[model samples]
Target chain A: MGFDGDDTLWHNESIFSMTQERFRTILGGIDAAEVDRRLLEAERRNLGLFGYGIKGFVLSMIETAIEVTGGEVDARDIQTLIDCGKSMLAHPVELLDGVAETVEYLANSHRLVLITKGDLFDQESKIARSGLADLFDRIEIVSEKDPETYRRVLARHDIEPERFLMVGNSVRSDILPVLEIGGQAVHVPYHITWAHEHVEPPAEGYRRIEGMAELTGVIAAL
Target chain B: MGFDGDDTLWHNESIFSMTQERFRTILGGIDAAEVDRRLLEAERRNLGLFGYGIKGFVLSMIETAIEVTGGEVDARDIQTLIDCGKSMLAHPVELLDGVAETVEYLANSHRLVLITKGDLFDQESKIARSGLADLFDRIEIVSEKDPETYRRVLARHDIEPERFLMVGNSVRSDILPVLEIGGQAVHVPYHITWAHEHVEPPAEGYRRIEGMAELTGVIAAL
Candidate 1:
């Protein structure tokens, strides 16, 4: 069994949402939608250059701040943006409701691997703080969670896609990719999703569960 | 045999040095020594928070700029810093002299694994662009190259430290840690080294080669 980090087993997207809100306030007077759009544009432009993570997001925010403000952004505001990133890095990893119990329950009978994508230190720190790291048989912090990445990971661990099952919150990142490579996946929607991770659900291929509470039942039924 | 990326296989610190010089010019009038001191301090301070890579380095640079300028650093300068980071990310991966030939030569007879430590995406992109990726039997991009990390990697790959050999430029990262775990290592010094990666050479137990040109000779003798 493979578990996706971020919004899958913890409160992740909500933190990003909160940070974006804070960013909106920092760039006050600008239309929130415009701020968001410009920030997202900077993020997309930088995605290939900076990749993903709070550090990249903060950098993009700084870039967008300068762009939106016509290069008149306060240095202190830039400092504020940097501070936001630091705090986000130091943000406590809060496991979602019933996550600890469900993960612990499943670990008893299965080899659970935590496969996450993000900044290495940030992800590792979160895993350490998540307090549930011990339940995982193996932990993979990847650069991205695409089909090729999943294929490489599964091959490395000597597992066939047919026997593998992935659980996560992002359909774009966690579900579609796994199913594309012949693996079973369960989609457990989170209340908040990043714009980059938003994608239409596949018409038919995977199971959808309300949350971690239904994970074990789905796994058993599989 | 395990090889370190960055300075080991290609040019890395030189790019950082050039960027730091540009930073100095941007913050002109500040004592270059003071700028270097403050930037290094910021980097060390944020190391735990930002980890390693151009993103974190750029963040530290921006933070230090704010500090040196007393929160009055120009927003355009901040954008310049961001641009510096983007260019660094887009910078070409230039392999050190003889690295390609040496790595390829060894790969024919030895299981060469590339073990590097840094941001996941940055390191992955570097490896891909290095053109030597196909020669590596396995590639491990870690957050830190501590003794415990080396041990974990070796164990995962079923490599006993006594039989494992590591080649890299940083003694702190690639040599001492591997030596501490009973692994044999060869130090191939780069022309420049990052301050964070500098450490006194181990008193004994590892061979020192001036560069990749001498790598295969040392390996054969080992």
Candidate 2:
């Protein structure tokens, strides 16, 4: 079994944040919180239009900025918004409750691997900081945690797809990909998720948990 | 003017880290320092192969594990390294010194925007946390900050590249693209960099600063 570090185990976001805040600050004096609420609503409404990813967030922030600012904003604000988009690429990684114990218990039963994506050095440094580096049998820091990552990690451990189960927060990168390879999947939802990783209707054989606290219970059941 | 978030204002690495203490704990009666030195040597030597992303660092860790264990490490040990990688993806945003000041100062005279790429919501939240969000006029989250993002952002700004200077750490995304559009580029190196953002044969017109702390001096001179 495995997990995706960002979102699943900890908070992770893309880089749309900087611009969003800049917009709020520049167009302050109004109810920016309500504006933010509306923008978030617009984002959810336009999820289908933009899909998830950097491009979608960029356009949405611009749209939201323009909508809330009532076209009083300028190219400078849009430019700053774009800049914020780039700077806002991640969420702070705080481990979901019980991540450690679940992994510890699962370690005795199934092979546990941690698969994730993003800048390599940043990822590695975080692992060292987390102080839970001794849990897994294999760690794969892939460019993208797709089916390829899952298959390769499983293959390295000589784990069959049928025998393996992927426990993660993302249905897009983690669960879906593993399921594609005929492996089982367990999803543990984080408080927030990247819009891009949203799966409209989750596929079959996918097990979900509200938080990592319930992870061991589900995995033990599996 | 705009700033690059990763590797400019912040220290970001895509590689998972192996601490010296962990090495000593794993391999008893061995020269752990030498092990560290050898690992560094391998990383420096293989930096070319990995090229600064998750794929590269994962390969580095795998190679390091094989070398230190002499190909005899158990699944648990291998997983330990793997977990280190999973742990790596969860690092918090570590902003570089003077970056906040630079953004704040620039916000006064110039139109500031955030031009960056990566995940969407993750980026937005980090900007809000950074406390410098009020300074910029806009934030743009992008998927890939290639010429396209520059082109779109520039067109929106109604400012030619000659009039707009893009300040960032990545040669590929920040400097080269700005230069490609006839804009000025100020490169402020961060403590660490993502692998894929690395550029070879530094292009002309790209001014380099030792770090973000010196950014103000260089910008004032410009």
Candidate 3:
């Protein structure tokens, strides 16, 4: 069994959303929607260069601030953005409801792997703080969670795709890729999704559960 | 056999060196040594929060700039630093002399693993661009290459420390940690070394080679 770190196990997207709100207030005169759109564009452009995590996001925010303000943005505002990033990095990892119980229950009967994507250091620190690191048989912090990456990971652990199962919040990252590689996936939607993570729901290939509390039942049914 | 990526296989520290010089010029009136000092201090302070990589380095540079300029630095100057970071990310991977040949020669007879520490995306992209990826049997990009990390990696791959041999440039990261775990290491010094990677050379346990050109001979003698 594989688990995704951000949003799936703990409150991740909410931190980003809250930071985005702070970003809007920092650039007070600009329309919030316009700021968001530009920021998202900068993020998309920088994804290949910076990859995932707060560091990259903050860089993008700074870039967007400069772009939107025609290089007239305050240096103190840039410092504020940097501070926001530091706080985000220091943000506490809050496990979602029933996550600990579900993960603990699964650990006794199955090998649990925490496969996440983001800044390597950030993810490793979050796992340490999550207080559930010991429950995992293995942890893989990858750059991107695509089919090729999943294939490589499964092969390294000597597991076939047919026996692999992935649980995460993003359909684009977790579900579609796993299903493409002939693995099973369970989608547990988070209240807030990043624009890049928004994807049309698959018609029928994977299972959908309301929350982690229902995970054991789904696993048993499988 | 494990190999270090930065400086060991390709040019890494030199890129950082060039960027630091650029940073000195950008900060203008500040003493070059002072700029370097403050930047290194920021890097050390931010290491826990930001980890290692160009992104974090750029962030530290920005922070240092703000400190030296007393929040009076131009926003355009900040943009220039960001641009420097982007260019560093896009910098082409230049394999050191005899590296490709040496790595390929060893790959024929041994399982070559690339164990590097840095941002996941940055390191992965470097590996891809290095053109030596295919020669490696396994590639481990970690956040920190410490004794415990080395132990876990060796255990995961079913390798005992005595049977493992690591080759790298940094005594701090690649040699000392491996030796602490009873593993063999060969130090191949690079022309340029980062301040954070500096440490007193270990007296006797590991062999020191002049360059990658001498690696094959050292391995055979061992």
Q: Can you give the TM-score per candidate against the true fold?
A: 0.98, 0.41, 0.99
Compared with the true structure, what per-residue lDDT tens digits does model 3 show for residues A1-222?
Answer: 899999999999999999999999999999999999999999999999999999999999999999999999989999999999999999999999999999999999998899999999999999999999999989999999899999999998999999999999999999999999999999999999999989999899999999999999999998
Minimal lDDT window, size 10, model 1 chain B? B194-203
What ranking of all candidate models by lDDT puts the best one first? 3, 1, 2
The 10-residue segment with the lowest total lDDT in model 1 chain A:
A7-16
Candidate 3 lDDT tens digits, B37-92: 99999999999999999999999999999999999888899999999999999999
Instruction: List per-prediction Cα lDDT, in the order shown.
Output: 0.92, 0.63, 0.95
Best by lDDT: 3
User: In candidate 3, how many Å is residue B179 off?
Assistant: 1.2
* Worst window of 10 by summed lDDT in candidate 2 chain B: B48-57
- Candidate 1 residue pairs in clash (backbone atoms < 3 Å): none
Consecutive 10-residue window with the lowest summed lDDT within model 2 chain A: A48-57
- Across A43-143, the per-residue lDDT of candidate 1 in tens digits comes to 98899988889999999999999999999999999999999999999999999887999999999998899999999989999999999999999999998
> DockQ rank, highest first?
1, 3, 2
Model 2 alpha-carbon miss at residue B77, Å: 50
Kindly list the per-residue Cα lDDT of model 2 for residues B88-182, writing each as its tens digit.
43456667777777777778888888876644334554566677778877776554577767887777667677788888877878888788878
In order, the TM-score of chain B in each prediction is 0.98, 0.67, 0.99
Which candidate do you rate higher for TM-score, 2 or 3? Answer: 3
Error of 2 at B21 (Å): 44
Q: What does the lDDT read for residue B137 in candidate 1?
A: 88
